[model samples]
Target chain A: NAGVTQTPKFRVLKTGQSMTLLCAQDMNHEYMYWYRQDPGMGLRLIHYSVGEGTTAKGEVPDGYNVSRLKKQNFLLGLESAAPSQTSVYFCASSPRGGVGQPQHFGDGTRLSIL
Target chain B: GESVGLHLPTLSVQEGDNSIINCAYSNSASDYFIWYKQESGKGPQFIIDIRSNMDKRQGQRVTVLLNKTVKHLSLQIAATQPGDSAVYFCAENGASGGSNYKLTFGKGTLLTVNP
Candidate 1:
């Protein structure tokens, strides 16, 4: 199985540019999440989706938006990228169970804004 | 603001030695904790997890101990090897709200095993 996969492994954007990151999972998980990993800052949640057609803002959702139109895919969009938004983005998924279940993660997408 | 944090930012061990990584959390209501290992250019991989009701849990070569009273968590690697070199993170769930799906992750501890 492919598990979780993220596209556009690396990208460079100018200030105010827009882009989208794609995450796909074959595990058929019921929950998906978007997180950004910054140096010495751990992973901060950007957005999440509990099920298809449902999305919720996470800890740091000011510059991002997410959509879970399909059960297997979650999309993260940066409407106007900023230098502060440059970070490695990770995607994760878990089974229907609550916090007890472990999450599976994708390699991640590295984005740099100048 | 309450957050999960690691006691040390880096650790180095000799081959065949035991390695211990420590974490501290301020949220008293956290009921579930997890340890993740991340290699260079990769995502965090689940190592093991323990619930607040339990004090300790063990996997193949790793053990996780949780001390809720002190708000402390630890991950112990039995045998340090080159493959064990990576950044280790601790995450907590059930911190706030009725949602149990959200987790607070620590900054991470880098473990290096030298031959």
Candidate 2:
């Protein structure tokens, strides 16, 4: 299984440019998340989806939007990229919700806004 | 806002020595905590987890200790190896409805195991 896979391992955008990062999980997990990792700052949640057709805001959802049109896919979009948004983005997925289920993560997408 | 923080930003240990990383969380309502290790240019990988009901949980050579009374958590690796070198993060699950199960991560501790 692919577990979790994120597209565009690297990207560079100018301020005000827009782009979308795609995350796909073959595990059929119910929970999927988007996080941004900045230097000296831990991974901050950007957005999340409990299941297909359901999306919710996370800790750092500003400057981003998400969609879960399909159970296996979660998309994070930057309407207008900013330098502050330049960071490594990670996608993760967890099986059915319980305290024991561990989250599996994708490699990551390194984004740089110029 | 919920916050999780690590006691140190970096740690160095000999290959055969035991390593311990400490974390402090501000959210008392957080019932679940997790430890993740992230290698360079990669995402965090789950190591171990503990619930508020339990004080300790062990997995392989890794152990997680939770002290709810003090809102502190720790990850211990016995007989650390060079492969253990990575950035470790401690995360706590919030209590809010929508974001209750969501994880809030600490800055992370860079563990460098010397051979």
Candidate 3:
């Protein structure tokens, strides 16, 4: 069904390199989010989008950026990759915003910074 | 800025045995709670959810119990199978101000099922 899809499943970059991770959902969801998971830690919110043209900062929004130009597509970018930024990035979507809604997640992208 | 956390980091169980994972949340204002299971190299999948007002909820072989008195949440699997091996996380969140949509998650507990 292609509920939520992420591209470039794995990537390795130098300390100062930059890259973009793409996420797309086919359920026509209105809310999308990006989170990073580290060892022995819970998933930390990086950035999120409420609609096609809206975005907001999350708990751990530092060192990352996100954009939602279309209803189904959400993009996460790293202006300058840091070693501390290496983690498993996950993207999720829901029918709408808020804590009451159920969120569906993509497989996730494994990013490594040298 | 409160958080949710698990008491145990890992739980090992034999096949056909029941599994119980516990979580504790620090926020009394949070009313919604959810459980997610994440396997290796994959995303977290929704297993079940419980609200603060409800004491228990069931789904398939899984059941979620919420104790508002102690701010504790637990997930019980009737008969955990090998497929049930994964990292389970409990998440809690609240909604207010017309736009605060945040879901705080716990550091997952890894469930190991022995065949």
Candidate 4:
């Protein structure tokens, strides 16, 4: 089974451009998250959803919006991409949001805003 | 703010040698800890995990040790091989209540195994 899949593995955009990153999972997980990874920095949470049709802000949610309309898909959107938004974006999911539950991650979408 | 950090940014070891990667977490309430291995161009894969109540846990060729007293965690790989080369990260469930599922990860340590 393909645990998690991220679409548009690589993309380049100009400043003020907009884009969406799609994350899909087949594991039927209850929790999904979006994060950004930068050089020399740890993955920072941008947004998350506890369940379908519900979303919440994370550590670094600015400039990003998320929607979980389906049980298996989570989408992250950049309304106005900036150079600083140029980073590798990762999507993850877990069966449940509880102790000892490990998150499964997708390969990631490499985005660059020039 | 509480955070997770690694002792070293990178580590190199000879093939067949044992390797140890260390991590430190500042949040005392973090009870669940996990280790992930990320190869180039791939997602982070779960290696192993341990809870605060337990001091050690092992799986396959890897072992995870958690020392709550010092807020330290470590991963031990036996007989390291070239395939073991990757960036290793330690993460903690720092959410105040149990099972929030959000984790704080360290910057990660790049481990290289030389033949």
True contacts kept of each: 0.59, 0.55, 0.57, 0.70
lDDT of 1 by residue, B21-95 (tens): 988898888888999999999999999999888999999999998888888889999988999999999888864
Tens-place lDDT per residue, model 2, A1-114, is: 778999999999999999999999999899999998888777888888889999988888899999999999999999999999999999999995547767789999999999
The numbered model that scores best in DockQ is 4
The value of fnat for model 1 is 0.59
DockQ for the candidate 3 complex?
0.62
Best model number under TM-score: 4
lDDT of 1 at B106: 88
Tell me the tens digit of each residue's lDDT in model 1 across A36-107: 998868899999998999999999999899999999999999999999999999999998635587788999
- In terms of docking quality, model 4 is medium
lDDT of 1 at A104: 82
Runs in model 1 deviating more than 4 A are B1-8
Worst 10 residues of 4 chain A by lDDT: A95-104
Every model's DockQ, to 2 decimals? 0.63, 0.61, 0.62, 0.68
TM-score of each: 0.95, 0.93, 0.95, 0.96
**Candidate 1: residue B100 Cα off by (Å):** 1.7
Evaluated at residue B44, the lDDT of candidate 2 is 88
> What TM-score does prediction 1 earn?
0.95
At residue B97, give the lDDT of candidate 1.
71
Query: lDDT tens string, model 3, B10-55?
Result: 8999999999988888778887888999999999999988777789
Query: Which is the better candidate, 1 or 2, if ranked by DockQ?
Result: 1
Residue-level lDDT tens digits of model 4 in B1-115: 1136433388999999999998889999887888999999988998998888899999999998888888888999999999999999989898687445889989888999999
